[model samples]
Target chain A: MSDTFLPVVAGHAEDGRVAPPSTPRNVPYQNGAPNPSAEALRAQFADAVQRVDVVWGETTVFVDRARVLEIVRWLHDDPTQQYDYLSDVTAVEYRDLDRPIEVVWHLRSLPHRRFLRLKTLLPKGQPLAVPSVWDVYKGADWLERECYDMFGIRFEGHPDLRRLLMWEQYKEGYPLRKDFPLRGRFSRSEQLRQILAQNPEAKYSMEELTVLEAFDELSLEQRNRLRSGEKVGE
Target chain B: MATTTRTIEVELSTTGLDAQGRPQRVPLATDEAGNLVPMTPAPALEPELEGEHMLINIGPQHPATHGVLRLVLELDGETVVRCVPHIGYLHCGFEKIGEYRQYNQIIPWTDREDYLNSPGNNVAFALGAERLFGIEITERCTVLRVIAMELSRLISHCVWLGTFCIDIGAFTPFLWIFQQRERVYTMLESWIGARLTTTLTRVGGMGADIPDGWTEDLANFIRTFPAVLDECNTMLTKNAIWVGRTVGLGAMSADEAINYGLSGPMLRASGVAYDVRKDFPYLDYETYDFDVPVGQTGDVYDRFLVRMEEMRQSIRILDQALKRLPDGPVNVDDHRVILPPKSKATSDMESMIHHFKQVMEGPRPPIGEAYVAVESPKGEKGYYMVSDGTSKPVRWRIRPPSFVNLSAIPKMVEGHLLSDVIAINASIDIVMGEIDR
Candidate 1:
């Protein structure tokens, strides 16, 4: 990551030549015009761009999971396609357990005024992992973590890929997965018992305790348990 | 422990009198001609202390946090060395619950997420669902939605300004702003019969049309609202204390702001003229004449200025919407999504069947997905929904602006004084309901 912060060049709206943008009218379903950049992406990374579908006036491009990082970096750095904004990072799990999970990234090219959806499928049998776009857009930090916490889709290159909305010691499995029950896996009384049984001292993570130089003062068994990766709730 | 000395430069008003009216020693010294000039003396040098830092935790429960947001900071004396924000205390899995509910049934859930911007959230979700169902709302419905959006923006920004003043030690503005907020709420109550948790919009239209004389009330608000805002501006915009506390704190450049996905007032304050209403232009916003306010040197001060200006701009849009609100049905004519009138449903066989089917199994969109974003008071709030040709959405994701904006708290709070952390966090305008959802 670069230490220096460089401002992105202003968008097309800054130029006086182009007409002011207006609301899109009568947008067709499934056959609307695809973003020009989608074609440009296919031409640039022929093998990586799997499929481009225009649904409800938005273009969604399916890409190979391995090259997602390279593609996102190029999109951010490329002058004509400066998708400097990362709108959202989320994963979708189909009810049919046999189908592959689709991890979605919503990227916007402010300069070009284009919205694009990038999806990569994680087959059921294989590990649910994909490259992180945190290197390209720093906004992906919490988003990717939330995706992992909810859907168990691991973002491979995320620096601190821990549970976001859930506590670090939470052992409820992925909440948004197809197999996860609506009220949760544990009974209400069990959930209350688990909550009450949690250790107050574990509120501060091991990393935070290290910052206080208090980690070395822990008991031998506690240190051994922490070293063995035993979480508080476990 | 070793004793350490840290010299801090504090900006004090040159009033020459303390709170008790006693003559106080000012930072400025009088020259021979009795002219007040800045004092120049040899600065005190401090000895380096041992490498010891203190950890401070502020709120998952503290009032100044605005909501249930916990920020754990590692401080070196008074300055923050590092900030690790812990959120999700308000998380109830809104998105997870959304997958189980039908499209219209999900409208009430939207209200609970961003409670402050409930009407705006309803409109945004309706727009996304309408797109998924390939339905265009009526003209009157469009104008009504615009009204709801601008009204919600007004109230949300009012709450923000009020709480922000309270956070920064100003008590008067909080009362003034909340008074203005109550007026908007009154109009909302008369229109939708609900105040905070207003499921104002249905998939193709509104839950109900505005009550009689509601436009006059709105017009009255639009006229009187700016005066209160101007009063607030007079109180704090140039106040030396407000400037001293907020100026140059938690600054972000335009490029950095965009990279961090900051939106709404947070992005506008960084000199980025990106407003979703202007750029994306849903709900016929393109036809409305309103300027997108941008700020220079994005800081807490700039965020304040941007939000204040945005409330004024919202009034402008509301004024236009009121004048151009066409006379037509608020709901669409499609029986698949909207039910026929109760009078007609009882008389006509087909209307009764349509009503029964709609009530039994909710209206389902085709197999597709749509992501609709709106210029919410907080920022670019988006609702992304995917339909699998079912009554309930396959996946519903809320692209929360505050969540992304709050993620950059570490960058903003680091190297600042511990007290300024509160000010910086307030400027982010985060709603934990939306962030943790």
Candidate 2:
């Protein structure tokens, strides 16, 4: 596919007039030749892997959700293809597309000096999950958490799946999704200030404070009443 | 294993007796059936009394930390059993904001990531956008970018050396290095008009050309910097206190560093010699000649040594780039991509209209994805951009090097002394702006 992606360098389309590389997509402007290792990988994971595509010398291997763990584990364990470094884990949300989110994993085989991008597209919604590669690379611990924190995508076997950049109790929509607005959104500073002010020494443990922070502006009595289903709760 | 037996000086008359007038022997452990059970004998110093585990909080506000970095350290006595870092105090959600802004507008946002390496960040972002747009810049642009990047790396190392020395209780190196750092800012000021947050480069090319006689200032800086480093080495490096504190502290093996996704000096210190500039060349770095320094043992001292050597290499690259600097247009001449020059926009009709359109509606790149990486002073700082054939990008993702490098801190600091955490953290050279972003 990469070899055939010649992108018509200053060449003409079938319509007779010559076309420039800058006007269209995949126009082979600066020579994004196909990677040979991607072809070798396709042969290696013949059945498990669906397809391999190279763009601008980057190899992206498309696989099913169930095979992500197996594919990554084998990649790490294989003698020649030891992608031991899990560099970055991020998701791109496409609300209009069939698969709403693409959970992208960028892996590096440091000893071999190669890069592989593993992407799994999933249906968009809350409580989405994929297999965790934490066991394979320890660096994925926080990066996976950050992915979950931002996109609400769960890595199924992640040991401690907690929000990383955003506070756990700031319950709201995922910031990175297209559906979320860019401005005039929620900010946790006021609530954080009140919580900090009430507890001078921060006597509450992390777990306890997380639970308390859910009632943003409610008083202790009102929160108890709401929990107990008593009168005046509304 | 040989066991030492101590001859007790207890008098026979003082021996407690049971009903049969024999000495009563207390059992160390007992079985469920009331029968005495044998237990493993204790070693000379029975480390069994290691005491209860305690929690140690390092910072979110601690002065020793480089910035607003909080570490929740689970400790057993003075040793760190586990170190969990809590970041994001400086989170401005730069990626989310980038989605709303035009491609060129995001360069300033990238500056906030690794504030110490804004020029490098600008180049990395511009390179990514340029790839998506398929705009190959001039040779002059590439050379200028290389010079700015190397200068940024030098400044970053300067800040790292100063703070790291102060962190390890060496007071003088901090003062000496910042003097060099001040000169770096001044040199950059001559070219870009700002010191820290210059926002100096553009997508298709540089914002502008350097002022006259700027390279001479850079050449002067390069000439006299090594002697200062040598002076610093005299103060530390082999100094008894420096070696004792940093030699074996926070040591990690090569496999462990790779497994934790470590890069730059941290990875090189482990002897992998994996530098993105060499492994994956960008910005005509392949044309340059320099050797990557690798260290055998990944420790605080090795990281320091690797960084010092890297500074020297940066000087070498800078010298070469200055000598071979091309003469041509700095910004790409494509009006669709680049903002028109001020003189042309005011004087010519076509340039006036092109500048108006470009300023109002930003460049519309084709619907595609591009990821460009540069070997930043900290690590591989990459910009992953996904465009949707519009003025703004659909997704703007940053592979922040400092954040990734900071992830290896817990792995480096675990099982080490608490104070060694400071040494290990400094060795990583984390700027919280990058990590939190």
Which one wins on DockQ?
1
Worst 10 residues of 2 chain B by lDDT: B1-10
Task: RMSD for all candidates, in order, please.
Answer: 7.0, 14.1
CA shift of A6, model 2, Å: 47
Candidate 1: residue B356 lDDT (0-100):
90
For each candidate, give its TM-score against the true structure: 0.92, 0.82
- Tens-digit lDDT string for candidate 1 (A1-234): 120121222333544323456777677997889998899899999999999999999999999999999999999999888898999999888888998999999998776677899999999989889999999899999999899889888888888787888886677899999899999999999988988876534566676887866677766766787789864322
Task: Give the local distance difference test score of model 1.
Answer: 0.86
lDDT of 2 by residue, B170-226 (tens): 999999999999999998888888899978899889987998998899889889997
TM-score of chain A, predicted model 1, versus the true chain A, to 2 decimals: 0.87
Top of the candidates by TM-score = 1
User: Which runs in model 1 stand beyond 4 Å of their true positions?
Assistant: A1-12, A16-18, A214-225, A229-234, B1-12, B15-49
